[model samples]
Target chain A: MSDLSPAALSPGGTIGILGGGQLGRMIALAAGPLGLDCHVFCPDPDSPAFRVAARHTVAEYTDTEALKAFAESVDVVTYEFENVPAETLELIAPHAPIRPGAKSLAVSQDRLSERRFLAEIGVPTAAHARVDGEDDIVAGLETTGAPAILKTRRFGYDGKGQTTVRDASDAERAFAAIGGQPAILEERIDFRIECSVVVARSEDGQAVVYDIAENRHENHILKISRVPADIEPRTAQEAAEIGIKTADALGHVGVVAVELFVVGSGDDERLIANEIAPRVHNSGHWTQDGTAASQFENHVRAVAGWPLVAPHRHFDVEMENLIGHDVDRWPDLVAEAGAHLHLYGKRDVRPGRKMGHVNRVRPRER
Target chain B: MSDLSPAALSPGGTIGILGGGQLGRMIALAAGPLGLDCHVFCPDPDSPAFRVAARHTVAEYTDTEALKAFAESVDVVTYEFENVPAETLELIAPHAPIRPGAKSLAVSQDRLSERRFLAEIGVPTAAHARVDGEDDIVAGLETTGAPAILKTRRFGYDGKGQTTVRDASDAERAFAAIGGQPAILEERIDFRIECSVVVARSEDGQAVVYDIAENRHENHILKISRVPADIEPRTAQEAAEIGIKTADALGHVGVVAVELFVVGSGDDERLIANEIAPRVHNSGHWTQDGTAASQFENHVRAVAGWPLVAPHRHFDVEMENLIGHDVDRWPDLVAEAGAHLHLYGKRDVRPGRKMGHVNRVRPRER
Candidate 1:
């Protein structure tokens, strides 16, 4: 367990943030209110974080010179995403303290490594096997059986690099669909609900998990997340316990999201690890308006070596993603009363793009 | 009551803001999430609002060219403060839609006008009279009685521009202290608690008020505000009714705050309108975390010719302003469990300055 006190980080301290997307932009927004100045380094000149940040570096992540300069500019570094290149992490590690560390990213970024690591730690996960080529895929399929997912080992998100192998006829198609890259084949586990546990861990090993969030997906894109997930109290507690242990196993400092599949029914809806997001996540968006401390702020605190906030649910919250054209409904949402709307300062809203979200909170009856 | 619907406006519309302080900065923050860009025209280049605003014009309020250019840049103009210069308002009015209108500003900018306007609308207010000179002051004092407060008709706030005429001996000092400006003398009402009502109105005359907020001030600067104010249910209802009527009387649009004195005791502690703020206000800061719709967002919604959100409070909340050196406690506040902290990106922290605030919320008890 890591043991870091959030109170040690004072106002006027500099926070180094990698990835300048809307998540990073929101993190910077949350950091501003704590008197913490943010230095955002992103390859894109149009990164929304740059608009409000105190300082921004527009250079590729792997550029050593730019990375070094960025590392030296801040007291600590935290990335908004896990896919940052390993070499970039090495270049930054020596200059400023990097959290959720390079090691955690190394495992989580690759599916093969993440599965092996989770299995080694005795965590319940899908039955799986790694495949490198056509022959390997066939052998793995024999062991994992049909009705499974074949996913590329790295750089896949939003269902972009995976295919479902329903039967023998689909095996070759699934393999070719993924371009036969180094991949992982896992037996699909039928589940009752797709839920996520978002936990923030400090260096001192203290962990806090927000209420499990029930997620609904559309075309592999997260469309909505509702807090107070429809699960028994015991199930929720067990999910949080798994989250705490996972953070500890990774030696994680900052927020980590564990995606889980709840199998069976009633008292037997056992949760199995699906994937890990080593940063503030979409599932936790409800915290922005429904909790005492937003996930972004807590993540910032964890990376900045501050105390962890006690995650709390202030209301039964439903958060819906405004994907592309859905954003056109901003006028209606704004007037919907009791809806907290957050739009990323993205210029163009294309199809499947996450432009904003609306959080509707229903207070408990008084 | 003015009536307007948000569907009447299009995206890329402009919102003219009056004050460029943190409240304006926050309003701009909220506006960005809804696809509405902000054009902040303030006298200070270092105004916090300038940091994140899409467009900003640094010019004196009295500069007609600057005000007109500012108005031309946006579809609608709203203000962060109520004391905008009347001449400046006239300059901007013709070029763009101005919310809460020039008349609302005229009423709020002067103490006598606000009281008279409230009184005319059947709203209860403290006894007040115009004080043009020493003779008027002497006669007004005799009629309004001793221990009354003498305040400037314009440019006064946070206990500034006012003196308490405790007796005959304090009359000359009170008169000289205000620099003999156009002033108003008011008989101070005895009150149990200082409370405020925050309301938003669309152009079409629809109005919505948040629950009454109880305020505590120290040295004229707001120190704390608690929502779900420990007031009677009828008192809260009356406060909202008063706010709606005030907005109707002024034909106001956008968010307006009415500060009131809860006079008398218990059941008899009726509400007396203190003053009106024709913009997003400090008293409603708790909405940032405790309510589904923050006051900043609601203000933008109303002025954008959109439907106003009737956001409900998620928790019973208390907001404490971090003033001057109090901001140094950010680390401690962030470390405290369940504390939602916000700091303005103000570079300097001077005494009595509002650096930021923290909201602590608890679930509403059944």
Candidate 2:
């Protein structure tokens, strides 16, 4: 086993966070209460996380001088997004320890590598084939068949850099739609629902999984997430096991969210791994109000090398995303009795942008 | 009704906070999720709240130019502490609305006035007499008797500015101990325990109170607060009712905590109002982890003129303050299961200084 006794961060230590989006803002907020300070590093001058952090550096991710200065200032390094460049990590790795590690980042950064890694760990995934050129797309189509998804291997999110193929004729068009990047064609699963398990693993390989979250998507963007997904206890247990196994396989020392597609009905229900997020996920936002400890706090704890607490749902919760114009309803939502609103301090509300979320929780039945 | 239709602040509006201590830091944190931005105003350059606020003004409270600029930058003004100078409020009152109002601040700032106001509203309090000189102190002792507590009428907190008089001859020594400031001599009550009710009131006079909290103090400083105070149902209800009444009486527009002393036994148990804090109290920190909505959020809602939510406790929570050296235990505390730690980003841990707090929550008994 890897050395379990990693150097734990002291209470007054500074945590270096990359990517100052909503996730980073929330993480910085969580770290404050634990006596840990945060230094947010993001390219955007108006990044939301900068408002809540003790210190921040605005520079390109690949700026070696800035990266080295930031790494030297903090006791440990963590990221809110998995898309951080490999070179950036390389430059800072020697200066500070990065939780969830470079390995987890490498796997999640590319669709092809993520699938291959999952398969190697014996985690069942959608039928997928790597696509490199026109010939590879044709061969990939022959293997995965029609009604498959063609997604760029890297830098794709919220349905960007992806397209659906219906037949052989659509293969070339799909490849062109994804900017002709190195890609993976995945067979679309006939599933009943989408769910995710967010787990946190400590340096010692100890892991704790939160309740499964049922997710709903609109235009390929997450719209809502409900906790205690309407699945059998056995299925839920299996999903948790998968999350823990994946986290262990990665040797990740922070939160990892494993999204899965649930197929079939009742006794035949099973989960197919879809993707892994190497940081806090939107689907786990309900934990902020419905559980004793939040996913953000757990992620902070893991990176700080503290023991993990398996948070249990104290309430049945529904978390609805306020995407773009959806945030205009903040007035009414704030007046709602059980609605807990959380808005990221973003200046503009472009279409499909994630502005905030509201969690409504009810006491769970005994 | 004093025009109950004051303009309510909309989301994205700026909130000007007068203190930049831990309380202000927490308030700023709570405001962020509600789509509101904070501009902390404090003289301390190292104020903890400055780290989280979107904007801040580091100038003396008496600086009219700075106060006016701060007032003009925000839609509403509020304070985390009651000690904000009257001149400072007057300078900013025309520029922005101040929640909890000047009346609440005027009363709570003086021990003599607070007691008189409570009596005016028919809220029972310890027998008290104002003392402006040695002659008044002698007369006050005659009326309140020995074992009375002599406290300054202004700026007293956490046991400072007060002394216990053991006998009539000890009055002069006790009075001198408190800097001979204008003070009040209060008859100390023989009580079983101390409890507090934290309530939030909106501009429209709508109010909501959280569950009562039982408090324990050391060296006159609050050390622990446990929710669902071990009291009779009727007593708890009565305490809550008194809190609402006090809030209404002061025309308070935000969170107000009324600390009470419990006397008698069983069915005969009753509470005597001891003090009224016009801002968030230390006792309500448990709500951060144990309730659907925290006191900080509710206070923000009230000051922002949003609808109030009467939060119910989901867990039995015990909040312990980390004073001075107590914060050194953070390494162990963060590893403890069910313990949620919150540290104010304060750099110094001077003796008796409030550095942070830990909330330990468990499933509440049905």
Residue-level lDDT of model 2, residues B53-147, one tens digit each, is: 88899999999999999999999999999999999999999999998899999999988889889888888998888989877877887788777
**Candidate 1 ranges beyond 4 A from true positions:** A1-8, A51-55, A166-173, A363-366, B1-16, B54-59, B62-69, B166-170, B230-232
Clashes of each: 25, 2
Residue B66 lDDT, candidate 2, scale 0-100: 99
Model 1, global lDDT: 0.83
Candidate 2 lDDT at B314 equals 80
| DockQ of each candidate, alpha-carbon based | 0.35, 0.49
Please report the candidate that would top lDDT against the real structure.
Answer: 2
Any runs in candidate 2 off by more than 4 Å, and if so which? A1-6, B1-6
Among all windows of 10 consecutive residues in model 1 chain B, the one with the lowest summed lDDT is B1-10
TM-score, B chain, candidate 1? 0.95
Instruction: Tell me how large the interface RMSD of candidate 2 is.
Output: 5.2
**B1-366: candidate 1 lDDT, tens digit per residue:** 223353455555667777778888888778766656777889998887776566788999998888878888888888888877778878987888778787888889888889889988899987777888877777787767888999998999998999888776676888999998999888878888999999988788878889889999998999999988878888989999999998888898888999999877677769988899888889999998877678887788888777777666767889999999998777567666667788787888899999999998777762
Q: Ten consecutive residues with minimal summed lDDT in candidate 2 chain A?
A: A1-10
